[model samples]
Target: MTKHMTRKQLNSRVVDEIDRNLRQAFDDMAQQPVPDRFTDLLAQLKAAEDKKNSGGQQDA
Candidate 1:
């Protein structure tokens, strides 16, 4: 027996598969940890901002 899908049905299946693949890729990326270099850079930026906010102090 041969089964034929309607045009709409084929489109729906294609959309579903694309959605599943994208979700899986996002989930895999979300599981990864942030790198230490970026963490350090962010911390340094925050410290600079804090110093600037306290008073525009010029470093000697």
Candidate 2:
């Protein structure tokens, strides 16, 4: 037996499949932990800002 889908039906099915897969991937990523590298980078940024502020105060 052969089944044929019309253009609209085929497009809807493809869209539904893509939406389902994207939702699943987002749910999986939400459970993961934050990495240490990100924290270290934030700390480095804070240190650089503090140094810049101190230098500006000396110049004034």
Candidate 3:
């Protein structure tokens, strides 16, 4: 005999499916490579921070 799912059980299943899909999408996106411009900008920012930390002179 087949068992019937209650309304709450159906809702829970739907929510679980949505959560799984969203997590998978995020995981896929996280696997992508960082864009060149973004990496370049981050490197520039780090260099500036390092210069400042080393007491490098600021631009006039």
Candidate 1 lDDT, tens digit per residue, 1-60? 449998999999999999999999999999999999999999999998898899976785
Name the TM-score of candidate 2.
Answer: 0.59
- Candidate 1's C-alpha runs over 4 A off are none
Candidate 3: tens digits of C-alpha lDDT, residues 1-60: 459998999999999999999999999999999999999999999999999999995995
| TM-scores for candidates 1 onward, in order | 0.81, 0.59, 0.87
lDDT of each: 0.94, 0.87, 0.96
Clashes of 3: 0
Clashing pairs in 2: none
Candidate closest to the true structure, highest TM-score: 3
